[model samples]
Target: MFNCNWGFMTGFGPGGGMGGFGFLFNLFIFGLLIFLAYKLIQRLSRPDGTRDREDSLEILKRKYANGEITTEEFSRMREILRS
Candidate 1:
């Protein structure tokens, strides 16, 4: 015999009745999301970001060897990369 009071039935319709427990649960979930995001970012960013640079340099070196770049350009690019 549950009489539904349509007035404030959902406590705040469409929003659901999360109340105190709801708020705490949401906060916990939000905190977990933030922590996970931080961890993911930390893992993605590293001093070994040099790998990408080296890979690009390798491509450039190959292009030079294939006679795609001028000698002067190759020397300049090599010097720039070494630094």
Candidate 2:
């Protein structure tokens, strides 16, 4: 049996902090990629707000037709459009 004495450790490791720094750098790059993906999806989902607004109106109309909104409620909401 051999006794090994490569004792305690910090996250940054013995006299060299680069491993921890590299971990953080990779994490940052990963987060940036995720953010860019989200933005790309958002951009692809709705290239223009006007079309999105029209789609929302169609959904609202469907909801109204399905009696999700009562006549009075629909009338009141007609004065205020949502985006």
Candidate 3:
């Protein structure tokens, strides 16, 4: 007869079903999936050129408000940005 008590044969083995590293492997895969999903959602939320233009305009406005740029310079840049 075959040896049924061999650890690999049945679920009653020393480390149980999946062995020691199984939990860690599953956890890693779960984390990877979550990270990919988050990145996909972030990418899908923004339109291509629109997000960049908006971000650039916001930065320009902040700089003007902070007095880092002259009013003439701000106006010029704002006009350029709007065009």
Best by TM-score: 3
**TM-score per candidate:** 0.42, 0.39, 0.53
Query: Which regions of candidate 3 fall more than 4 Å away from where they truly are?
Result: 1-18, 65-68
Q: Candidate 1 lDDT, tens digit per residue, 2-83? A: 8775532343334658666656666677799999999999878866658877987998899999999999998898888878
**How much lDDT does each candidate structure score?**
0.77, 0.69, 0.78
Better of 2 and 3 by lDDT: 3
Please provide, for model 3 over 1-70, each residue's C-alpha lDDT reduced to its tens digit, 9 standing for 90 to 100: 8745643333334655676565566567779999999999999997778877888999999999999999
Candidate with maximal lDDT: 3
Residue-wise C-alpha lDDT for candidate 2, range 1-83, written one tens digit per residue: 98554322222345544577755765677799999999999889965676867777787788899999998877666656662
Taking every candidate in turn, the Cα RMSD to the unseen true structure, in Å, is 10.2, 11.5, 7.0
Q: Where is model 1 more than 4 Å wrong at Cα? A: 1-48
lDDT of 2: 0.69
For model 1, what is the error of residue 17's alpha carbon versus the real structure, in angstroms, after optimal superposition? Answer: 31
**What is the number of backbone collisions in each predicted candidate, taken in the order shown?**
0, 0, 0
Name every residue pair that clashes in candidate 2: none
